[model samples]
Target: MSYVVTVERVEEQPAAVVHGRVDVDDLPEFLGRAFGDVLRTLATQHLHPVGPPFGRYQVDGDVFEVEAGFPCDGVPTPVGDVEPCTLPGGEVATTLHTGDYQRIGAAYQAVAEWMGEHHWQIAAAPWESYVDDPTVLEPRTIVRFPARRAS
Candidate 1:
């Protein structure tokens, strides 16, 4: 699918997150388990999600150090591996992807190309917010790359 990348300001968001270093091939399972753990923890604690599930990825050679969770009201107590955290707020290059998760990389590539063209420097780990339920139909995800004008 084609993506229209755009730059926009994002506000700080509080979340419950789980971090782990996972191989690219194992990312799906890792994210699944991580989100499940977070959701369960929130339910057990009577915490409600304020937004959809989100994931941040930091590439390190062949593996990706990832943090996955859902945005929620003020941080809930740490439950096992899920911890309280915040998704940074600032300018970001973003695009929406409507399709399977396997094809989401194209959206990221589009954002990277846009960043390059605009001379924007990536300031933090990129993240993807799942906007639709994957089990029902084609999912919609917003891919975001935190950035700033090159100095």
Candidate 2:
């Protein structure tokens, strides 16, 4: 599928994040537990998604950390005992990807290729936003990377 590539200035987002390197294969299951179940449970209590779940962060040591489940409109409770925090905003190179986790690298590579072709440099770690819940469907996710406007 084709992705509508563009740059967006995201505001500071309040969310809860987990930091750890999981098996690439378990990324989906992990996300469901970390995001879907968390959000679904929150929504039931009237907590709705304020923004998208951003993740797939790869640090220098290959640390795959994720900050997901944004603040909702309802009262924050101890449903799953997960607290919320804010995620700072910046310009990002966002795109969507289909299929399984293995193919994700290709999608990321595609983004890098695009950036190179356009003379844009990535300014921060890449992040993935869980658009579709992997618990019910294939591993479809949107990849976003913070970047500065190339001169």
Candidate 3:
């Protein structure tokens, strides 16, 4: 799939989050649990999601630490494994990927290449916004990386 990378400013967003460390093979299960708990909590609290679900990844070889959740209005009270948090936003390099989730790493690589070509530096952990339901025939996602000009 083709992707266009761009730099954009984003505002801080509130979300229900669950953090954990898991291997790439376990990502789907981790996301399911994290998003499920958050969605369930939101329903019980009458809170609605304001945007797509996302996962911030701090990658370490085959295993990674991830914080998964959905952006929502003001923070909801913590419930079960879900906690209230904010996705700090600023200048970011982002690109939309349309295909299977297994190919997402290519999107990340594309963004990193874009950053390098543009002399930008990654400022924080990268994240992926799930723009469509995973069960769809073609899943769409926006991979984002907080970035700034290289010193």
Best by lDDT: 3
Model 3: lDDT equals: 0.91
Per-candidate TM-score against the hidden true structure = 0.88, 0.67, 0.91
Give, for candidate 3, the lowest lDDT window spanning 10 residues: 79-88
lDDT of 1 at 100: 83
What value does the lDDT take at residue 9 in candidate 3?
98
For the record, the alpha-carbon RMSD of candidate 1 to the native fold, in angstroms, is 1.8
Q: How close is candidate 3 to the true structure, as a TM-score?
A: 0.91
| Model 1 regions lying over 4 Å from their true place | none
> Global lDDT for candidate 2?
0.65
Superposed model 3: Cα runs more than 4 Å off: none
Q: After superposition, how far is residue 24 of candidate 2 from its true place, in Å?
A: 2.8
lDDT tens string, model 3, 57-77?
A: 877999989899999977899
Q: In model 3, what lDDT does residue 58 have?
A: 79
* Clash pairs detected, candidate 3: none
Candidate 2 to truth, TM:
0.67
Residue pairs in candidate 1 whose N, alpha carbon or C atoms collide under 3 angstroms: none
RMSD of each: 1.8, 3.9, 1.5
Residue 22 in candidate 2, Cα distance off native in Å = 2.2
